[model samples]
Target: MPFKTYLINKTNNRKFRLDGVLRSRRLPAKHKLCQKFRQHMVLRTDQLPPKVDLRPDMTPIEDQSQIGSCTANCLAGAYEYLTKKSNGMNMDVSRLFIYYNARIKGNY
Candidate 1:
């Protein structure tokens, strides 16, 4: 089946649409890295760099090609949240990165 992308910005409640198709099943099976990215991160949260808090600024992120790659956005947001938490400052994460990662995850 062909998949569509959709992105929603939590900060300003904006939405971004992208034109593309993702065949989750067709993703290269040999690229274990692709499948394991999230899992790997989950196991080593403490080791990973802390995320920044971006809520204070709450600047919305962009929707990447409308591909519904929210995971990347969430990751970016987390980074922003952590950053702010550590330094008492906020940051805007790149939504494009989130959208891209979501599509890579396929059905994530």
Candidate 2:
């Protein structure tokens, strides 16, 4: 018998984390157990209703510019703002600027 890690995805958007002795090819066993658990939960939901709540606002997502380097395009602008507000450092390095430099140098 070989040791294995079984990642069981359940219907209720939950997972079954089982790490112990299981029979060889016990996938059917795990799936049946998860189904039984879901059935039990559905029976309990009759007594309790779920609540719908909205999450709090953190900040707005910045627009993405097509300058090749999406990684720097996203963070470089945000980091400029953060550094300017917190540490009083004015650093403006955009993906468009980098792309322009790369083009001028005939490297890309």
Candidate 3:
């Protein structure tokens, strides 16, 4: 079944379509993150440093080339970043290897 949704503004009424919006299933309670792991910061602008940028320390962008392996690419980037920041090594991680093991670990 298809349904129509409308959005109205005080000044002008506009028609909008929301049928293509996607809804995801909520994660099970057991899978939810612990309260300690979740951070909810409340701070004024002056409380923090004026600027913090880490792009210069990141590895060069890796090309996925139309592969549906974003999970692998993301993990590889983070791993490379940690290695570079900690050991001062700019080694590149293999997305193919990560994707392969990720599929196995995830049972995909």
Candidate 4:
């Protein structure tokens, strides 16, 4: 895992550390994901459902041990969800396939 660490400027004789995704990185800004979705009418706060549960749609958990393939695993879960939603079939997807392809494209 690649992490960039930074020290805060407003420190009073104490060290403050911050570590997270690098915002300036290309991947984070390269795509505007929101634009891909169809625009829907904005719902008023009162019109929204009181409770929403998507857990029912989610399949069984997948253990990823420690191979640093979080992205691939996430994509696989999403793919499984789409598959089930499209054809109502619970399928096990190959995380390695997605991982290898992403790694090749990303050059990680």
Candidate 5:
């Protein structure tokens, strides 16, 4: 078992105060967990294709150069890809529109 102590406060009048203690009991060793994680993340680089372009049709590489609206751009791109794939329709969704709507909804 491992334990950690957290200090709540150190007031000018009082010296110090203990806030809480966190105790953790290990079911498996650290090395074992690391080995398992490494095994899960192992990839065969040679088997992968040299070039993979998964972008959908009408999915433009947007230049959100001036605006800080990367989240909106990504959302619109995903929407275009999904809609095109599902319905075979090539509709260009406006990133600015999505950005404004998200800002109104307080999502950003």
Candidate 6:
């Protein structure tokens, strides 16, 4: 079957209207990075230093095994960094929780 038909059937099983949900959501405007790049006539390669490590202070590298949870893992890492910077607390957000939530929301 076609992708659209598959999506329609899946949404129907969940008693959800994909069209209505999509229509209700507002599309995001152009990203700030895109806007900044658009205004420049030529790319500025010299502005940034040769070796810049912008890694957060307390954020540690994470490894997500065989499962398809890279996005969730990255989000958890970012959350950990933000929380640590905002307050001096080193809290570990569960990647599994994020992954499960995203999966349930039909985003995975």
**Which candidate comes out best when scored by lDDT?**
3
- As for TM-score, the candidate ahead, 3 or 6, is 3
Error of 2 at 68 (Å): 3.1
List, residue by residue over 28-58, the lDDT tens digit for candidate 6: 5756534333453764789756885656556
Question: Relative to the unseen true structure, what is the C-alpha lDDT of residue 31 in candidate 5, on a scale of 0 to 100?
Answer: 66
Give the Cα error of residue 93 in candidate 4, in Å: 1.6
Question: How many steric clashes between backbone atoms does each model show?
Answer: 23, 0, 0, 0, 0, 0
Error of 1 at 15 (Å): 44
Reference-based lDDT, residue 58, model 2 = 17
Which pairs clash (backbone N, Cα, C closer than 3 Å) in model 3? Answer: none
What lDDT does candidate 3 reach at residue 87? 88
Candidate closest to the true structure, highest TM-score? 4
Model 6 / residue 33 / CA error / Å = 29
- Off by more than 4 A, model 3: 1-47
What is the C-alpha lDDT profile of model 1 across 1-108, one tens digit per residue?
446676989999787877575545556757765664553335467776688654564535556566665667667877876777678776777778667556677774
Report the C-alpha displacement of residue 94, candidate 4, in angstroms. 1.0
Write down the worst ten-residue block by lDDT for model 6.
16-25
Better of 3 and 4 by lDDT: 3
Least well predicted 10-residue stretch by lDDT in candidate 4: 21-30
**Please, what are the lDDT tens digits per residue for candidate 3 over residues 1-108?**
446676667577666665755544565477545333436687798898998999977999989989888989999999999999988899988999999988899898
The C-alpha TM-scores of every prediction are 0.33, 0.26, 0.54, 0.55, 0.46, 0.47
Give the TM-score comparing model 5 with the true structure, all chains together: 0.46
**Candidate 5, lDDT over the whole model:** 0.75
TM-score of 6: 0.47
Each model's lDDT: 0.66, 0.56, 0.83, 0.80, 0.75, 0.72
lDDT of 5 by residue, 14-37 (tens): 434344455445555566564434
